[model samples]
Structures are given as C-alpha cells and as structure tokens.
Target chain A: MPNKNLVGIFDSDEKMLHAAQKAKDLGLSASDAYTPFPIHGIDEILELKPSILPKVCFFGGATGLLTAFTLQYWVHAVYWPMNIGGKSFTAYPAMVPICFELTVLFAGVSTFFAFLFLRGMHPFKTSPFWGLQTENNKFALVFDLESESKAEKVSSLLNQEGALEIREIIE
Target chain B: MTTATASSEILRPPLVEGGKTYGQITDDICAPMEKRPPLGWFVAFTVAGLALLWGVIMVTDLIWTGVGTWGLNKTVSWGFAITDFVFWVGIGHAGTLISAILLLFRQKWRTAINRSAEAMTIFAVMCAGLNPLLHMGRIWRGLYWLFPYYPNTMGPLFVNFRSPLLWDVFAVSTYLTISLLFWYMGLLPDLATAAAHAKGAIRRFIFRTLSLGWSGSARTWRNHEKASLLLAGLATPLVLSVHTVVSMDFACAIVPGWHSTIFPPFFVAGAIFSGFAMVLTLLTLSREFLGFKDYITLKHIDAMAKVTLLTSMIVSMAYLTETLIGWYSANTFERFYFINAATGPYRYCYWTQMLCNVVAPQFFWFKKFRRSPVVAFIISIFINIGMWLERFNIIVIGLHRDFLTSSWTMYHPTYVDWGLLIGLFGLFFTCFLLFSRSLPMIAMSEIKHVLSSEKHGEKQHA
Candidate 1:
C-alpha cells in the first residue's frame, strides 16, 4: 500500500476549528494544520505544547543586560579611567540608558531568530502544501493515512464538517 | 428594537470596511504591487530622486571640503545637522508607538496602518542616522569610533560609556535594529500571500526568500503570535527609552534652555506630536493615491487625530512649564534664555513652534475637523513645521547667545544646510515610493484575523 496524506480544506477558520475538534474526538491524528492567520483555540484542539519563545526572550534579555553592564564597567572603570567632570569612574548612573537599550536589542533580536529556528523557517524553503492557498483564504488540516480504508473515513469526516474540498497526496 | 439588539447596534463598527472577504483583502493590498507603477508614483519618485541626488552632492562636498561647508561657528557649533537628527528621530517614535504600543493594547484598528507606519519608522531612522554621520566631518573615521569594540589601535581607547552622545549611538542603532526585526516579522505572512499570487518566477522568488518560506502552519502561527506579543512588550519601553536618551543628550548638558528636569517627557510628547502629524500627512496622501480609503477610514483618521491632540496638549504644557521654571529659578541665564526665545532674534522660530505645535492641533477638539482629512493633513503639515522649528529654537537659540557678550553671535544657515534638509526629504520620499510600489502596504493577514474575530464576535452576540 502507498503512503498517503488526507488534506481537508475549509474556507473559514471557524469551520476548520470545528473539524479539527471533531477529528480529535474521532481518534484521527492530524499531522499538521494551516491557516491564513492564527486561529484561537486551534492549538488546544490539536493538543500542541505551549511555545517556548517567551522563555528564550527572557534569557536573551538577561544575557544582554549582563553583557552591557560588564562592557560599560570594564571600559570606564578599569581600561582607561579618565576623570573629566569629577564623577566616579564607574558612573553606573550614566550607563543606565545603554544598558536598557542593549537589553531590548538582545531580547528582540534573539527571540526573532529563536522563533524562526523553532519553526524550521529559512530562506528558499518551500511549503509542501503551496498549491492549497493556505497562506491566503483557505484553512487546511492534513492527516497521514496508514491504511487504504482510512482515506474514505477521513474524507467522510471532512464532508460531514462541510469542507470546501478534500484531496489525497502520496508522499 | 429590543435592548440587546439596540446595544449590539451601538457596538463598535467593523474595522475592515466594504465587507471584504479574506481573499479580497489580500487582492486589494497586493494589487498595487502587482500592477504597473502609476503615473503619480513615477512623477513623485523622480522628484524625490532628484532631491536625494542633491543631498548626496551636499554630503560629498561636506566630506571633501570639511564641516566649513555648513554654517557652524564658535558659538553655534551644532546647527541644522543636530536639529534635523533630533527631528527625524522624533518622527520615528510614532511608528513604534502605532506598531508596538497599539498592538499591546489590542487596538484592532492598528492592523490597517501599522505596516506602513513601521516602514516609516525604519526610513525616518535612516534619514536621522545620516545627519550625525554628516556632522562627523570625517565620517569614515568617526563612524568606527562610536562603537566600543576591543583590540583596536590608538591605545585601544574605548568610547566613554557614560556620555549621553555615546548612549545615543547605542539607543538609535538598537532602535533601528529592533524596529527592522518587528517590521520584517509582521511582513512574513503577507509576503507569503504575495508570493502565492505573484505571476512571475523572479517576483515569486524574491518574496519567497524575503518571507523565509512561511507555511502559515498552526504551530508556526502559535509561536509567531507569541513572539510578536513579546516583541511588542519589549518595544514599548524601548521606544520610550530611545527618545529619553535623545533628550538626555541635551538634558545632561549644561545649556540654559536644553537643561531641564522635564526634557525627557517634553521631548517624548513633542516627538509623538510631530510623529502623528507626519503619519497623518503620509496616510492622507497614501489613501488618496493608493486607493486605501476603505481600509484607512475616517475612523482611523479620527483616532490618529485624537492622539495628535493629546500629545500636542502635553507638549504645550511642557512649554508652559519650561517658561515657568525659567522664571522661578531666578537664574539670570535661564530667565534671559526664555525671554530671548520669545522676543529675541530667533523669536519667529519660537512663535512658529508655538502656533504649529500648540495652537494648530487645538482644532482637533471639534469633531468635524477631526474627521476632515483635509483639515487633518493641513494641521499635520503645520505640526511637522512647528516641531522642526521647535528643535531649531532649542538648539540654535540656546547656543547662539550663551554666557559671554563676546560669544553672542547670530548664526545663519548657508545654502548647503538647506539643500541637505531638502535632500533628506528626497531620500525619505524616494524610499517610501519604492516601498509602496514593491511591497504590500497593508498587513493582509492581520486584517483577515480582524475580520474573522469580528465575525466570531457577531456570532457570540447573536
């Protein structure tokens, strides 16, 4: 038997969410789901884990703050301690702005890169379901078919949920 | 009608008007990019290109002939360059406010204008960055000196981390980087949509590479949403801090008019005031030229006008507070500076700033004016002028007549100064025109999200 995946396409996000929930109840494991925008409650229905990007941002910010403070301290106090206005060599008060700036810079840049890394996104990578119009109006759910008989069951399920179209693609 | 039905009618109207379908939203936005450049775009682009060319010539002359090309003297060492820098940087703040702060506040209306506003931020910062580099005299040497990289020659002398000038280097660059990231991230899903609709392979290849192969998968969307929220959170404070640091450039100094406890908030308010005006100016033109009137509706203009009004009042209050403080201080220099600002040689600039920044936006108090695009656009232009003159008054008036009678020299801007200013506008408009022609000006995916949620809300209410 050839390996195939059943794809269900819906015009609206609401229908897709409903279909996804019903598929879960029916014990059909959906390999992936796609939408034009982030649909509320779809993650819960799919039983996906919460994203770890926030944690990445926090750590990235912490590292940036440390780096800024260390660089400022070393440059002003230790490296070439020049006193112009009789202020202290450390002058941490004056260092606050750059510290704040670097913290945000590090956090923002790192989190963006981390997001792309986690999602396995990079230039020149093409979508497998590029022809489905999922990036525009359509919503899609793909289920890997283990048995030939399962195709009919999946198509019937999608039909009952009012799918706009359904297709089977051999991998 | 029943009470429930009446209340439902009273609810806020739809954000995306014309009852656009998801596909229609994508098509409307992508249409400009897909079609040939309009005649108006070509004419505007040509004018801007010429202006940029003039500016490039001015910069090259300044570099070759030295800072002597400008009107800088012993008294007013920092003239048009610094003022233009602050003005441009201030202009960028509104973009960040719209894209990041409004996003955090969950203002669905922001989906209409945030993409272009964020683009404005990036381009404004680019223009802002040019002034400082030009002011450096020998920019090639001055550029690397701003950074505190290690293992360098000249005794490995590190830049003064305590200096507000150095802090500006850090703040502005970080601001540019973060704004670029936030803007690019917002563009990904829309770029993918554009790529899908793109006819030619080259166009498709360009957008696909730019979009990083966005699949719009639910898992990716989940993470993308989280990252956007986190970035918005980061950017809010970052935006505030950037202008605060810019203010500190003067606040930390001992100049009579520049030194004030109120500089940060004052500058921030004025920045937002000017920025919103610029947004108004651009959006009014864009909606007319690009035919985005439906998406950028009267409601959006009203909201932006209200923000401009609020910031204008804050700026007005700051102006009053500064004058009051100068009077109460009993310091001869401070008192003289305030009085001189109003009635002295540079009084025209001061009065212009007051009329434009303070008095002009007062018209927004009336509903008819707030809703009137013509009124909003005209007032925005006034505010832009007023804000520029505000910087000029602060920087030049503060410097030209300082402590000594011998140092009291009136500064005049040579033609080069004016040329460079015109050139910067040229650079800005040129970039903006190209951006509008090449990219989707509106955020298609966000608009779709708004449409679906509106539908969801209607269902819940029913």
Candidate 2:
C-alpha cells in the first residue's frame, strides 16, 4: 500500500467511475474511489474480484436442507416411530416444507454475516475514511500515489482535470 | 424572494415534461384526488368501515358461538371463509410478485403498480389472515398453531410440520413479513422526499419518525439499494413458496379430484393470473379517479395486461392438465369428480370460470384492447369472478361428493356467507381508499429512477 495521503475530487460520479476504471485497466495497485452515492460498477472498476457471499449462501442453504432432513428423520423415523394412520416413517414428501423454510432462513442469515465480513463492518469501529460529506453532496476519488511528490502531482492533476475541490485526508 | 433565492441553486430540478420525481409527482398525482369533495370520501369510508366492523362482529359471534352459527358443515367445511382466504391471498401475490419479480427482470413499467400492489398485498394478507382464525372452532387456540403451547392439549401440541396447514402458516407469515419489509424499504426514499417538501409540525414529526433521520446520503442510498435487492431476492422465493404451500393443501390430500402433482405450479400460475387482473382493476380506477394518466400511462396497462394474458394461458393449461391427469390416472372416482365439476349442479360456476379466466383474457392478445382501460377493467372484474368460481369449484365439488354414495350431498353458501363475502369487498376497498389518501400510491422514487429524461445525454444502457 502507498503510504502517502492522497485524495482527488471529481465533478461527478461518472468521472470518478471512469478514473477508477482507468486505474484498473493500467494494472495499478493501491487505489480507492469515493462518491456521493454508489456508482454501480465501482468494485469491478477497482478489479476487486467476486465476493465469497454466493459460496457462503450456497453452503448455508445446503446446511439448512441437511439439518431439516436429519431432524425430521430423527423425530419421525427413529425417536418415537409411531405407526400413526399407517403413514410411512421415512416420509420424504412431508419434509419438503420445513426443508424449504430452513433453507431460506439459513441462506438469509448467513448472507447477512458474510456481507458484514466482506465489508469489514464492525459495530464499534468508526470508518477509517471520513468523507461523510460524500454521503450527501460530493463525489470523491482517493488515490494512493507512492511518494509525497507523486501525491502532490495527483492532487494537482485532479484540480486541472476539473475537480471542484481536493483535500488530503490523514488518519 | 430571498427565501426563493436561498433555495434557487438547490436546482429546481427541471421538470421532465411527462415525468416527475418522487416529491414532485405526489402533488401532481394526489392533488387531483384530494381536491375531489371530502364528503364522498367520508361517505365511502363510513359505509365501508361499518361493513368491515359488522363482518368482524359476525366473525366474533361465530367464534363465540362455534362454527355451528355459520352454515359450514362436514359437506363443505371449507366454505366462503376459505374462498375468501384464497382470494385475498391470491390478490396479495400480485403486489409482491409485481414489485420483486419485475424489479429482478428489470421491467420499468412496474413503477406505476408496485406501490399500490404492495399496499394491496399487505391489506389482502390482513384479510386472508382472518380466515384461519375463524376456521378454527375455537379461535382462542390460534396460538397452538404458531407455538407448542396449548393448555390441556396433550403430548406437546405443536404445528404439524407434515401438514399442509403448517406449510401455509410458515409460508404466509414469511411472505407477509418479506412483503412488509420490501414495501417499507421502497417507501423510505419517497418518504424522505416527502419530508423535504413538507412544512408543518405534524409533517416534520411524522416524517422524522418514519424516515429515521434519512438524508438521501450516498452511503444510505448504497445500503438502501443493496437491502432492497436482497429483499427482492428473498421475496421472489417467498412468493412462490406461499402459493405452492397453498396448493399443497389440496395436492397432499388423497381426495379424488384434489390429489395431483401439477397443483402447485397450477395454483401459483392462477394466483399470478388473478393477482394481475385485480391489479389492473385497481390501477385503472385509481388512475382515472386520481388523474394520474401520465404517471400510470396506457403503456403500463398494456404491460400488465400482457402479464395477465400470459398467466391466463398458464392457468388455462393447468385446467387442461387436471382434466388430462384425471383421465390418465384412470381412477373412476377422480374422473367422476372432474366430470361432476364440469357438468354437475356447479356447472355454471365451472363454465363461468373457464370463460372468464381462460377466454376473457384472450382479448388482450389484441394490442388495441390491451391498452384500453375500459376493456382491461371489465376483463379484470371477470377474472375476479372466475377466480372465486374456481375456488368454489375446487373446494365444493371435490369434497361434496365422497367415495361413499350415501355421503354425497349438495353444498351451498348461506346468506351470511355471501354477505361476509360482499362485506369483505367493503373491507378491501376501505383499506385501499385509505392508502390512496394517506400515502404515495405510486412509487415516486422508483418512477424518478426510470424517468427517461434522466437518461438524456448519458444513456448508460443497463
């Protein structure tokens, strides 16, 4: 990661997005972008590969289905297998509704946790980036230019490229 | 003038001729409706409210006096109560299905119908929710179905996971919760927009409470969008599960006419069919009454009608499949029940159902008729009627005649049953009319997102 504190402001979200894309096309490392709102393709523009959410959700759902089956089998077939109404003990068709419900429940809960993990969101921690101003009005693009000179050059380049304003944010 | 100047650079947001943002559209859409005489609304609400109140009283009496007070007997235990349940639940489907499914498919036309449809879903679920409570002879024992708690009931009485009724309990609850969240999530942005435009102490208090300090910030919008997408994803499956579980109520049964592998998909298709039709009916009346022609354009009607037509065909195919399966199964009792349904004492209902659901929607295949509100409204009414008849045929004809010849009996809903059915219309309309007056009936924010002018120079094709 580049140590220099460097940030660029852009006129609009579209420009910030394009800049992010261009950064990735050239295969640069240590970069990030910020905007007033979510620009749809930002993650892809940053060349952040696909998330682990889908796999986690798949496993969660499978676990739910398996758990549902196991519980039902234990209850109906093994635990107190009563021959009520002459129905079969290993009744598969009857287990579908519970299995389906559990699948959705597991998928939903697991996906939520995975999302928090991927975003590195913790309840107690304040965000490292403080462009809450970007939360409302501004579109910002933060770049990790390597040296102090390079950071200044990047800041000046953003201004020259029609950025409304620029400010280096430090932690 | 100074105040105007202070707000000037806030960008008056140049109006896009026919389209308006969530904030701007509300005044344009609701102003005309509200400006119409308050007396008419008062009278309508009063009458509808009274009827709904009466229905509740009757339901209470039934609960107190036992199911004996009503005309429900062993011959047709699933009477108008269940019919209303299915009808209301089916109506509930169109709203969530329209909102979530169309959003997933990226259908822009859903903008006009989604908000009202979701409200309809909520209200319809409320109405459907009444049936099961009333169905149980002792409404007090309703908790036994939700939990394992029942006083004096032996062996840890729990919801039978193997039972279709239990599936319905979970499915409907999940669908209702998901739809509520989806509806509220969509409303948040619009409510914020409304808050910005609002002036009074009441507006500020209510909006602040409802909006939870929303500022349309980038982070909020980002999270809001993701949450909405996730909700829509969840709701799609919930919608399917609800109707499938409802179908299982019959499909799992060994009743001659009810047991069929095709019932789940068939019920779902019919649910969508009747749902879209009901939406068309409401949308047509709402647009006309509210003067929202531009907001809810002829194109929207056309799009919804096309869905109606598509689902109608699916339902019709299901009808055909049931008949084919009856023949293929070679079960004399099944064949007899099917034949009785089509040509017996309930023949009128069967024919009307076939004509209205299968035949009437076919008129929409013509583009001109599809776009006509009058044609769509009439067809929708027919569909509602047909769906009722379909339920009647299924519940009554299938069960009225059992395997034993001596057990055969004719089923008819008494005056009270019919009265409650009509009164429920009053309940449905009362809730709908209130929704129209109080809330943004059309989704203002979603419509703004799809507004063509937003794409003028920077058309980033989705």
TM-score per candidate: 0.97, 0.79
Off by over 4 Å in 1: A1-3, B1-9, B458-462
Tell me the interface RMSD of every candidate, in Å: 1.6, 5.8
DockQ of 2: 0.14
- Model 1 / residue A66 / CA error / Å: 0.9
Off by over 4 Å in 2: A1-80, A85-90, A105-171, B1-23, B26-43, B146-154, B452-454, B457-462
For every candidate in turn, the CA RMSD to the true structure comes to 2.0, 7.5
Deviation in Å, model 2, residue B147 alpha carbon: 3.6
Residue lDDT tens for model 2, B229-346: 6667877887888888998888888887788889889888988889998899998988787767887888788889999999999999989988988988898999998889888888
In the range B1-462, model 1's lDDT, one tens digit per residue, is: 355545654687777789899999888999999888778989999999999999989888888999998999999999999999999999999999999999888888899999999999999999999898889888888746688776866566888787899999999999999999999999999999999888899998999899999999888998999999999999999989889989999998999999898999999988888889999999999998998988999999999999999999999999999999999999999999999999999999999889998899999999999999999999999999999999999999999999998989988999889988999999999998999989999999998988887766643310
Please list the C-alpha lDDT of all candidates, in the order they appear. 0.90, 0.72
Residue pairs that clash (backbone atoms under 3 angstroms), model 2: none
